[model samples]
Target: MTGTDTDSGRPLPRRLLAHVGVAALVYLGVCAVLLVWALVVTARETTDASMAGVIPFLATAPASLAFLMLPANSVVFFTAIAVGAAVNAAIISWCTRALRRGGHPDR
Candidate 1:
């Protein structure tokens, strides 16, 4: 197995980048859906619908780190989410790879 991958025949780093990209895209998609919901709420309820936009950040465990590290700004929030997505992807990739190796349960 390459240091990057175990048996998938793909480089681990590339897989990691792809995972990060897909995960970040999914996170952004959630943000977009929430944004749309916020817009709809704003149009219907005449309220800012702050919760709609903030829920993803507040609810997603990974993003909470970014949210806390940075200020409450849109660009920063998105960046933080993307960064959080990468961190999450890396962690998940590592965990899954470790599990697949099948050495010791305690390891």
Candidate 2:
């Protein structure tokens, strides 16, 4: 019944941002789990055979430092994952605000 509620009856961009934030949180959770697994593997005296298989791919990827240092590897991996997730959340927030200001209704 309000300007925000079109015939489809949606609350618009703020609502969408809430959804995006929830999804980003879920993704961050998964990343945390994976980082824990990586740390466990790295802590082992022997290198992870499975991880060794991916060495070529990782070697070609940016920030090769993760493949070299001990604690630094885990730190860099976890930091990058956290930072990337935060950046994704921020971009979603920015887009939502932009759409709302531009008068775009909910999809």
Candidate 3:
């Protein structure tokens, strides 16, 4: 379940790939829920109040530190989803790798 990291000689989990998948599920799952909520809110009669754009806007709010090359937008939400997932996966991987051996010292 672990592999050696080339850069720091740390034991990175092989499940890092699985972590990305899990992160994707979590990220997109939230986006889907927000999409549904947005639709529902749009459908309701709220006397000039609505959450159609605002609710789903969160999908693109957090820029991925790991993958920032692609512009996050509706036309590219597919890529953004993967980018978001990879960022979360990378963070988890780094934590697990660093924490595995008394934690790496910041340099």
lDDT of each: 0.59, 0.52, 0.53
Model 2 misplacement above 4 A: 1-20, 49-75, 92-107
lDDT of 3: 0.53
The candidate with the higher lDDT, 1 or 2, is: 1
| Candidate 3, superposed: residue stretches over 4 Å from native | 1-19, 47-49, 63-107
Q: Which pairs clash in the backbone of model 3?
A: none
Q: Is candidate 2 or candidate 3 better by TM-score?
A: 2
- Find the 10 residues in a row with the least total lDDT in model 2: 52-61
Cα TM-score of candidate 3: 0.39
- Candidate 3 lDDT tens digits, 1-107: 14443434433543434444445445556766776676577678675335474554556446433334557555565455446544554565556555654644752
Any residue pairs clashing in model 1, and if so which?
4-12
The best-first sequence of candidates by lDDT reads 1, 3, 2
For candidate 2, the TM-score is 0.42
TM-score of each: 0.51, 0.42, 0.39
